[model samples]
Target: MTDAFSSSSETVLQRVLEVSLKSNTPVDKLEELYQIKATCDFILEHQFAKVALQFPDELLGDSVAIAEEINRNTNAKPFILGDTSYGSCCVDEVAAEHVGAECIVHYGSACLSTSKRLPLMYVFERRAVDVDRCASSFRELYPDSRSNVVILYDVSYAHAVKDLVTILSPEYPNLVSSELVVEGERCYSPGFIKRLNNDSLPPEQCDSQVIYQFGRQFSLKSGSSITDYSMFYIGEEGATLRNFMMTWNRCSFCSFSPATMTGRAESISVNRALMKRYYAIERAKDASVVGILVGTLGVADYLTIIQQLKETIRRAGKKSYMFAMGKLNVPKLANFLEIDIYVLIACPENSLLDSNDFYKPVVTPFEMEVACNKQREWSEEYITDFRRLLPGGQSHVPLADQQDESDETDVSLITGVLRSHNLLNGEPAETPSSSSMVLRNQTLTVANTNSAASFLAGRSWRGLEQKLGDTPVVKAVEGRRGIAIAYEEEGTAS
Candidate 1:
């Protein structure tokens, strides 16, 4: 926390308890809500002497109370972390390091990116939703639904899932629940499923099919393959929904909003995003200087992705620079006029920044890889997880789909769906300026060769010059045609 917001650990705990009492929140549920018991158990199991408690802005009110409870129950010393360097969703490992804490216990909504150094124990916030009504809406929306109905939700709505299952189990026979078998924090998307393979299946999934759980385990009544299952998401139109649609575009999907109490069929709107993403990819290929924005340091495997991106840019014969700012805003980036494109290495949730209003385009690390890798082809598959982009995690592109080396030059890299077409007027746009198409000036200049001291040593820095009218200054003073002297009298007097 900042200095202004700082309070004694005991005072903070007392204030949090007061706030908790006014809300009529149960004291017993506090342990489950914050996962206090599990977090303490984890500390004991690991025998960590020092533990850090990280909370988002909204969760700060409960931080002190949680820390006190942890300190009381376990032998570990619990310390509270205030503000974070980047997005609060990421574990504030740097803050923990300041206190010499061993690990972090993160609370509230998370991006679920793996922590690089400090091991993170995430306690996602669970808000109560009307499961009975939500299930009724699902039942009425799709009467005689297929056996394969996979249920997914935002981490916030994770609590209602069990009740939703109990209500819909009788009507929907094959209700599927998923737990991510992959490493790191679980993302809010179905793309994690594509990363699933035979070798990566968890212990419970060993004998079962190749299907891995997305969030938590929802045991199917009977064994069934992942075929025509309709994905029913209990969240909003966010990153999770975008990822879910991208992975299972062919399958029927419906999103039921617990807040609105409304259910609607998700059409090809998700497809529109695919086109936008492709357009961004095409634009990235034309960029000369790419700014790699360190969107997140908290997500696991971020450093690996940054290294891969730099190498990719180098291989493509382009230049790249690294930037690290906790938060990214258009104005902050606009200062760098030389940068043509910015590739964000952020959490998938915060990734895909729309640079339409920006002076330059912004892209993701995945897009950077696509633009630079000659072996990569434009595909429908988009990777949001950086861990998946690692060497072993990289998905193999089919040989038939890979582009040949010779064809790379002949193909128009900038030719995309938006080319030659004007969105405003229903007519062809004028040709782009030559300056826009020209290659960046890669020539480096020597500072000493054009030094002011060397040039002005012989020349006079004064007003009106010479036989000719006032002349412009030249680089070298060796052979000058015209001269001016404003301080002639002062020089003579001195």
Candidate 2:
């Protein structure tokens, strides 16, 4: 019995440390996987002296070896960057700049959002896929050869997309495969550029030939709309799939996991998620104080979005605060109890924060726009990217035409209380005069101010308070000084 128990414990321990049991990858294979040669060429071509190599947590194991290889191949100094200041999917331009890195080479899965300052090179480590199995799974899910299907995939399995398409195109004529383009002139599709340049035409009317969501771009049949087609995703379920689903919520989705070698129809609906976002927007309208949380510094136009959000909040007659703390959690946000709602400006994939774990509700920039902009209206279409909310983007709503709705009085559905929008106009509440004072059950009850500062003032522990001039001052006295581990006074006594 004792021997069996020990053996079982050993098995569990091995399972827990299974990642360590994997054999080290060969140098030659690692070079190919990380595209070390290409990275070195990019650095040398650009004449970058200091190069920053950014890797996600899962890919950190091979970061050192990859960095060394790059260092040996090129004259540029290579520095490994981990614990990214923002989402790992984005290039850590902030951290790269800290070391004065001239360029950033990001490894592992990426969101492909454009970086602001530094040049970025992505090394999506190639992962093996059973092409035959994938083709077979595709056929099973989409049996009709003429089905209007779009093939979206993870960047790691991007190498196999060509072969998969080659095999399926012969039979499936209406198949469309999305390409992940990060940098260079090919970054934005023609349709995307047209939409950005021309705002007079509605998005749907602005060339339905192509569609761009997040960083993935694809073209549809000449006359067919994206809504007319079904989406077929190749990769494990993750942020990529979730973003895809949210963006093209109208299309039916089916995903095939290479790891599991199984294909299934995606039944997860974005309707519930959309409803939650709408609810957050409604809550924002009722908020008197808003917190603008900077969730990313790498994505292009992040600063512009931050400024826009501030201006929008100000125009709404609400108090606004900006925070740039790296990474967000309950404790960090809970510290700012005065913030009625937090508007997270981050990459699309990281924007929709789950509010369940948070003390205060967190919302995306799009939702914030709808809540703050009285001219903006809620619709079936939802935008996750902050860039689209910029001045010229399709979803951009100008604040110039906004009507003054502050004087309107209505009841809050959330609080079920009669609330006045005028309370959020940043005007100080009037103090009751002594002549109008009335007794209420032998206790004084003041009218609710319905403001964040008023809420904080009512809290039991409103942070440390300095009673200036109230407490008597004492003469200073010398105290024993020593290291934290062992004090000098204690050592002398012993």
Each model's RMSD to truth, in Å?
A: 13.1, 10.0
* Model 2 CA lDDT for position 435: 25
- Across 108-168, the per-residue lDDT of candidate 2 in tens digits comes to 8888887658777777868888999999999999888989999999888888898999999
lDDT of 2 at 54: 84
Worst window of 10 by summed lDDT in candidate 2:
1-10
- The local distance difference test score of model 2 is 0.75
**Candidate 1 overall lDDT versus native:** 0.64
Residue 198 lDDT in candidate 2 = 26
**How well is each residue in 1-494 modelled by candidate 1, as lDDT tens digits?**
21112322222231322334222335677876777777778888778898878778887777766776788889788777767777776676766776677888877766555555776676678776788778877887678855578887877776667677777887776677654332443311221222223565457646655443332344443365444577788887876677667655656788888778888888766578778888787778766567889977666678888988886775565567789877677789876666768898887667756778888888877777777775667676776655666777745321222233222232335653222111111111232332222221123211111122223333455334495656767687554333355344345333
In order of appearance, the predictions have TM-scores of 0.70, 0.80
